[model samples]
Target chain A: MNRKKLLSGVLAVCIAAATALTSAACAKKNNKDSGGDTAEVKKLFVDLHTLMPSASENATPDQPHPVNASRYIAAAYKSLTGTEIVWASDYAKPTDNINNISAWFNQQINIKNCPAIGFTFGTKMQADGLYADLGEYLERPNPYVAGNTRWKDIFEDWVWDDPAVTDANGKIVSVPIVLHPGSATAIYYNKDMFAENGMTVPTTWNEFIKTIDDGKKVPGIKYPYVPYTGDTGISLSSWAFRYSLSPGFAAHMADRTDYDKNGIVSTNELIRAVLEGAFNPNVCQEAKALYRLAYNYYKTVLPGGWESITDTTYLNAWDEGKVAMKNQGLWYYTNEKSDVIRKFDFDLFAPPVAQSDSSAYASDLPRKKLSEGYRSQVLISFNVMLPAVSGNEKLLEKAIDFLMYLSAPEAVTAMVQENGAGLPAVKGAEYPSVYDDSAWLDREFTEIGISEWPLGFIEGNTANINAAFSDWVFGEKTEAEFFTIVNREQVNGARTMVNNMKINTAGWNI
Target chain B: MKDGKKRKIQIKYIIAAALVSVFSLFYLFDFLWAKTYKVEVVSVSDENPVASNGERVEIAVRVTHFGKPANGHVIFALPSDGRMLAFTTLTDENGVATLTYIPYTANAFLPVHDVEIRIRDQSNSIFWEINAYTDLELKMRAR
Candidate 1:
């Protein structure tokens, strides 16, 4: 009996020790305090791929990441909302295919529990069911929320209130977060060169081309103007198309209920004009000449390897007095900071309007006063999702509050503080103090701000535009062939994608 | 005294100490490697603001380390002035600009427009205010 009792005691002790250890190990696994577990404040991951990759680790304030605007948003969230937001530069891998970002997002962010917010180019962010309806969160009656003028009115008109656009169930799904307005399509010129050369700022299309050719003849001047067509591939083409159809394209696209409608009033007409003016070699003979002049200038005027030179290189060439005029985006100044700007004055003008008349530049002088319009990028309400598994309501609320704070007047100002670098989506938000006191405020922030366009269609057609432009640039297809391909193939492809996705196909009927 | 156990404990202590030292050294190297650069803005033009004959313009700029300029090429571009009236120039070691005139009328130049300027390198970049130095208000006076 004594031997048996001793044996039983030892077995009980062993079992108890094992049970205690197993419980302890499980507890350690559940511990949120350690970096390894998820139970503590669940970590939400954000991937900011819109910026170029940085090789640096400890990205500082002054020497902040190249995408400091995004970093500023993250930092501001931590300070204003008091939420712990951590972001890793390496969160996105090389092969993170943007096409199926919804699936990629589901895998990387583990949206079943933690909520996350981020900015991406239009194509990737629009993938299906990757977001939650932020309408209720955005419309809540907080004063700070209501006072943010930028989005208050814009949301109803452009963002959530669009009748044509609907989510998976035909409900509003994604919210506009950061908008990059189409780089305003305008003509950039050298004032000193124009004056000295007796060149009038070309107001009509004929005059503009004549002015360019005329400027080429002036003694010692390289060329009156050089569009950086060689440096920027589709961007130059996009600029060309916009200038060709600027006056009526927006309205036609905006009210485009019947996609196949004809005449100058139709979107197809505008698209056709762009196709002919840009891609139709026979029609755009003059346009092609303009493009050739631009490319030739890049080859002859720009130093060293013109093909490898960046946008800034051509811009610097302009600054160095190597070229006379460059047709480019407004960010040209913000992108290339050279003292040449001070030495020589430059100005923005609407591209000379095209006309059917032979003396287009002569009689159509009044129409020339109308400059090109700006394309807008907006900051719409960001989408925040509560994982069905982690359904942590507290975390959801915190993220919503963070967005609210970001939309606040003060916060908008803080973000816009980086002048020419960014603008806010908040409507009626006072111009940033940088602009508040300056005369250029309207031109820099207001006039240049990205305006909302037909969002869904724009997002859908981005790839088609890319492919079409690529083929046209490398001469794989003639301009007319390219246009037909873009219209019939690209736009039609987009229409098919929308139909397959069960998206509304009214405006794309053509 | 129990010599065997004592010797074993001493060995363990030495191992822990060496491990800690390695980690500290690793951290020190990373911190040193990530040191911030003292980026200074240099002029790309031979003149702070170059003069022009109303036609051709040229300018130059460079990046330097410890007062010795780096050999990398740099850019100097002009901002738009509403009328597309301005041209830009790229710079070499010392930025210089020259402009010849085609003799347009006097109303061409707008007064007091703002010029935008920017520069960048491998690690960091800088944006400068150049209107602080040059006048953008010059008008095309009829010769």
Candidate 2:
């Protein structure tokens, strides 16, 4: 009886000690002061590093409009936060790897004496556990969170859950500031060349192949079609696969698939078909086609390309009597608006959709994730983060307010008027005027629009896609061989991505 | 001989006097017979003399001859720029003229001054003018 009593006494002491330690671990920091003025809030510092294309020494003033994502985001954030933000611009840095970034972050954090929010194209820091868990902010009512009803409601219902932001891991880590939607890949033929030879837009996969083959029979033309090789080539060919595999891609992402489901059909067959259809002999056949089409189309249509050409020259071929079309994004409006090309009086339209009962039309898939261009090639693309460095509540509030402003009709109108950004994620913001001055482009989309989701932006899916594309384009792999590699890569990459992403599924009743 | 010379000079003076009298009568008839016209101007909303804050200002002008209304081009000009702002027509039968001028907010970048309306007719070589003023006093409501 005495031994039992001693054991009970020891257990009680142990319980007390455990409770004391637990309390200490869970203790909240004293964020508030007696005066209610509060503790000195630390300033959150952020660095928006972005790439800008530089002009060559002999380049004319008409260089391509460089994407200043960081600048626009910073302006909007500053307008909303009303915080005096100090910024540093890093020009022409090629390597976007997280390890390279971590070194920069460590250096900045130590020197600046502030917890830094590195506003990058991806969640490199967050995946590394260098950034805060934005999950807490999403749980509470916060405007910066993308999927919140108050905020996400402003965007189209389709975009609210664009696959770009929702990877296989189901977490949105980077915030896409500018979202370029639809496959910018379209077959642009020499209008005069096609007209002189009697050609039209191909609607079916079979027609597409036959047309290219027929074009090659012409004596003067080098190849019926040319396609980009290496990275560029793969991206273009991938679009062909993307459209063909749209239904399965959408189905699998919708969480309707089983583990045993082989969603991909004829992955290798499709790759071989695109390669054969392209009809170009060279490795970088696509880009060469673009350049050739520009020159040939210019000789007939526009008076200009007789001189050396720039990127605008490629776009002008479509407008100024060169090429009949070019596969590019809606933001190609900027390219069309270029001083020399503006005379062409261009129009916008969606690429032809392969007939599918299961695939949702592009118009139906309203929401798009703003992913980086390179990565979105393989996986989902989107933007999904808020900067944590500013630390100023007002700044954060203002940033949220700017997003709210983005939802406003006036803000959308301004963006459209400037021809600055691409599609807005908001509902009712879709209008004909958003694309071209013509009602036809708008009408075309209305007639045949399909549901679309932007790919994941933050994670390493971009690298995976690029790798897969490289193997398909340059590597000596059969169509079956290429697809096998692609599927394996997707499965392995997806698992790693989900493991890194911390998803918050609160209030998701569905 | 002197008497005969004086009589001839008197005949020449009489011929010169007759020509001057005819020219004076012609000038008087032309001035008195020229066409004259008046323009009647009013706001579209009779109940409102002043524009409701953020509302458009509607002005109407009419032209008539011998109490029968006429229809032709009417030029409306603003006092600030002295450029014709708008051109419209009077009703074919009623000769009623109307144009809307949206009032600007005090903070907005629009000229605040008197607006002028002028009407001209090719049928009678007659023209008429009218003027209206807006103070632009209040803050506008959010759009």
Candidate 3:
């Protein structure tokens, strides 16, 4: 009995010790993740690619990792996925204006070999069949985005409508990482000149133009306003001038809506009316009012010698304080510190409503409040794609899986803040104050303005449109001649757009 | 006394004396030699981040010894009578010591500045003398 009692005590002790150790281990494992045991994770072998080659590519054995933004992203990705990213520095940035990343696809680098690719807003070889039809991949539920929200639903719908991203079949071919492609025009006024002349930033459109003419009276002011007509990208005050003249043109340009059926007479319907000869230059009351407004813009507002100067010259003249007011985009003067010093501590100017009478339009323009038409169209740019060359039966899904990780809103926004020059398409991206101001992102297009999309669509591009518009501004083209040319240009694009209208059948019936 | 009895007592006394001496020497050597430690002020960019007055700023620090992460508690001695986010904090597994500093006012004159740091022993006593240098700058401008 004594031996049996002793054996029982030893057995109890051993069991207690084992139970204590198992409980301790279970506790340690539970502590590893605070959220839950629902830690579903996948391993990735495909390397993260970058737009620029890693700086350490050609290093002579004594180099640290390339200190660019991609390196940080690679580190974060490894932490998330437990995989190493391959840095291909031999594939450098676009040399001689040729994108080597795209060239690789053209070169037919095996899709299994090409992991991840990034490029700016331009020709993405979608037509060449080099790009994967990313719509299905984007539509899949993103594992990173907390719950059921698909990746496609993250960005604004209007972004995919860009004629650049949509193929002939009306499918969105790319996934954009950065949104702000081009800059919106804002007035930068010389504070010293304004203070000296007792001139304040104008609230009304007529006063704003009058201030420009009156600003020359300030000391050392030659051209009171620097309008760089030579810059083809700039539409010679088109934001304030042209957009205000006709608001909401892009929305209804190809809409199949009938007039008099609805209260809202869209800008495109009015353009269609003009095309149908409903608004002529001379005879019709509506046509005469529109013509008179265009006449006043050319005659009174435009600087006579603007067509002679180049964009660089105009900006240089502004920098020297030879001008009182200069208008440019957020990206125009990148170095804010020097721009403020050179331009006499300039301040932002709110644009006054276009002084052109909206009531004069019998269907040409919308008679709306300044607040209703105050927004600007932001150019959504940049996309990353898993090329179609990687057949789905193969590791295309794996490449796409890695892409989903890299392009997660959190991941992409971090990259934009660290590396990209413009705004992020992902929500909650904080602007680095050193590079950009948070306020410049705010602006609403009062009118549904047409993008420079057709310029990319039409064969020869926007230079022709730029030259023709410049000619009209300088009287190189007569009023009758300019109207005829612009009208013909729109009619030509309308044919192609109307056909694609079948595939993208949902939006505004256009 | 018998010879055997005397020999036994002598051996016991000798063994006791050697043990006392060995213990004294062991403690003395511990008091004499010093262990090496490494503390680095991580490189920060020119946008020396500083919060506007009435706001706060947090900075992280790392502690290491013999090329390995140094664990346990650490104390930071801030410059200009400035206080730390924590008077005392423990180092993470990676040896990162997060220390926050809030300036009542922003001074851009010297963007780069320094903070002093040291390690504490198990009993929370200062175990090491700190190496001081200008590794930090007040690059933080008034927001």
Best by TM-score: 3
Candidate 3 lDDT over residue span A1-510, tens digit each: 699999999999999999767645533332222112243323222323333335653212122112234455566666766645544343332422224445654442332233344342333344344445677777788786667368777664555654345554546665655544223445677787788888887644456677877875666777787642423332422454443333322222323223434433332344334435443334444334544454565566656656457766766776687777766554443333223225366765444444333333322323333224322233333333444224332334544555666566655554554333455555544432322232443433233333221221232223354456567656788767755554455444443343433323233322
For A39-136, candidate 2 gives per-residue lDDT tens digits of 23222233434322123311121332233323344455555654433333331222354445556555444433222334443444444444333333
**CA deviation > 4 Å runs, candidate 2:** A1-82, A85-149, A167-197, A204-206, A218-324, A337-348, A353-409, A427-434, A445-484, A502-510, B1-143
Query: How well is each residue in A1-510 modelled by candidate 1, as lDDT tens digits?
Result: 699999999999999999767645533432222123223333334443443234442323233223344455556455554545544344442333334545455554442222255443322343344455555655565444544434344332343432212232334444443333333444667778778878786654556667767766777665456554533444333444334322222332323322244211222223333322322334434333433433333344333343455666666667666566776544444333224354577666654543334221111212211123333434333455433213555545555555565556444443343223334455534332321211222342122111121212333465565566556656676666655544454345444445444554344223
Best by lDDT: 3
**Candidate 2 global CA lDDT score:** 0.37
Model 2 residue A223 CA deviation (Å) reads 6.2
Docking class of 3: incorrect
Model 3 lDDT, residue A369, Cα: 32
Per-residue lDDT for B1-143 in model 1, tens only? 59999999999999999988887776665444323322233322222221211222122334444544444323322222111122333333433223211111111121232333332233223322111123222232223
Q: Say which prediction, candidate 2 or candidate 3, comes out ahead on lDDT.
A: 3
Best by DockQ: 1
Chain A vs. true chain A, TM-score per model, equals 0.60, 0.53, 0.60
What interface root-mean-square deviation (Å) does model 3 yield?
18.1
Better of 1 and 3 by DockQ: 1
